[model samples]
Target: MSPHFPSMAEPGGRTLGDEEVAAAERVIRSGMLSAVWGTEARALEREMAELYGRRHAIACSSGTAALHLAVVAAAPDPGDEIITTPITDFGTVAPILAQNAVPVFADVDPETGNLDPAAVARLIGPRTRAIMAVHLFGAPAPVDELRALADEHGLVLLEDCAQAWLTELPPLPPRPATPLAAVPRPAAPLAAAPPGDAGVRLAGTAGAVGCFSLQQWKHVTCGDGGLVITDDDALARTMRLFSDKGWDRAAGRSHASFGLNYRMTELQAAVARAQLAKLPGVVEARRRTAVRLLEELGGLDGVRLPRPEGHAWWLFPLVLPGGGAREMAAALAGEGIPARAGYLEQPLNRAPVWSGPVYGTSRFPLDGADAGRGPTAACPEAERLVADTLLVIDWNENYTDAHVTAVADAIRKYRPRP
Candidate 1:
């Protein structure tokens, strides 16, 4: 009989322990459940900010809220464009629409399913206001190149790190040899970076603001929560205000600007704090097991394994270049290995949302725009990835060496034959 594979949905797969329980009790006993009046959420913010080496971290209701906050910081006018990949959670694109901006779908790298920088460069135009990049399945996006484009075009760059907790990024490339005048100035100079940041470049620190998720399935969980980190004081202040219904606590009961009630509660914050404490161990274990599986499946044909460098291993993805993901997933599932073909039924460019009215029977900003035509034609690589090439296996920190072996055996058996 095969051993049971642990999953993120259950306690066995999660790192939750007595620590999380005690945190909940502490918050309950304090009689303060609201973040606005509680210390727990504020403390969580401080810890997250410090962990990411950012000047500020604002805790919010969900990952979508965090992305929404970043969009708010961009302050897009109606119909302004924000380019992003189609291979990510809708949460990454919803925020653009929520802020009345048009999302321009950019094609992804065929292998990694991350936004292709060259594709993004092609889409940038007069009305382009920002670029939102997702580090898909914890593989680092090429933020250094994306940042360069943002700087050149005076665009805001937002990193969606929901699936990328502790995902390390490559070091910045050496300075270009171009003349100073030829290099465009950034929209705003980044503030002084935090101390001791020269060692590791984590996923969230490369852009203007990095958004993280604390949803139930994330590396850490508080049921549903999020945090956005940034070094810019102005961006930090804007996000803080937006998360709290634009209320300025410093100004006596006065409303400051447009916003929402996206604040994280004390209970959620407390639980997340406990989970955060265990995050390093969680990520390390995941890396260890994922790398082991990579080794086991090293020389396979007709499929490409994800490169382990700086990957958090959210889901172990395989790209069957010859196109048999569906069959391979079915084979793995038959052997009791949890796997799925196509992360989504279809990429976001072809999502059903695009076929319907976005706002109460009105498309508004989408009307008379390239978006109305649907960007499906614009991102062939992303479309093919979702419909044919991609496969993802459920992964978590609790996976053992035996589990990795089981997965490798099944994949080796089912991999397309020449």
Candidate 2:
């Protein structure tokens, strides 16, 4: 019989245990569940800030909420644009729409499925307010190049790190010889590489704000929670206020600005703290197994393997450059291995939501000549990836060498024969 593969949806595939249970009990015993009056959430923020070496961290209710907070920090005016990859979760684009900003879908690199800096640079125009980059499937996006591009254009750069925990970014390349003009405002300093992270930058640190998720399927979880890290005091304060209905608690009973109730509850915070302690181990195990699979499949034909360097291996992605990813996925599944083709049904630019009214019967921000106007860009690379080349196997820290071998054997058996 084929060996059973573990999945993130089940307990056996997760890291939760007595520690998380005890954390929940501690919060319940405290008799304070709301973050407004509880210490757990605040403590989580402190720990997150210290971990990422950021000056501040704000805990929120969900990964989407964290991205929304980052959007608020960017302060995009109605109809301004945020350039991002089409290959990411809708959560990445939702915040841009929530703030009445048009999302410009940029093409991705064929291999890495990351936003191509050249594609993003082409999309930037007078109305562009920010650049939100996602480290898709835990592989570091070309943020250093994106950062330089953002700096040259004076755009706010937001990193959606929902899928990347402890994913390290490569060093910044040498600056160009061309003399670029100064930005409208000084850019915030990137977070210093953490101890033992010598010579490499962390994924979320290059941008103005880095957003992380604590959803159940992530490397670590508190059911559903989020954290945002930043060095800019003003941006941190703005996000904190926005997450709490714009109430500046220090200022007596007055609503300070437009905001939402995105605060993380004390219970969630407590559990997340327990999970946080186990993050390094979780990522390390995932890396170890993912690299092993990469090594085993290194010489396979008609397929492209994901580069293992600094990847947190959220999902093991493979590209069938010669096509037939769907059939290969089916064959692997028939053998009891978990795999799927086309991470999304379609890229966001081609999503059905765009063809309909965006805001209660009006396309407001998406209506004008310069507006997004539903599937405007070709994004051919992203389209081809979703329709033909991409395949992802469910991955988790619980995967063993035997599990890796099973997957490798299955792939070797069913890969498209040249």
Per-residue lDDT tens digits for candidate 2, residues 245-300, read 89999998989999999999999999999999999999999999999999999889
TM-score of each: 0.94, 0.94
Residue 236 of model 2, lDDT score: 97
Give me the runs in candidate 2 sitting further than 4 Å from their true place. Answer: 173-193, 369-375
* Per-residue alpha-carbon lDDT of candidate 1 for residues 254-295, written as tens digits (9 for 90 to 100): 889988999999999999999988988999999999999999
Model 2, residue 176: displacement in angstroms?
13
lDDT of 1 at 389: 95
Clash pairs detected, candidate 1: none
Worst 10 residues of 2 by lDDT: 369-378
Off by over 4 Å in 1: 174-198, 371-377
**lDDT of each model, Cα atoms only?**
0.91, 0.90
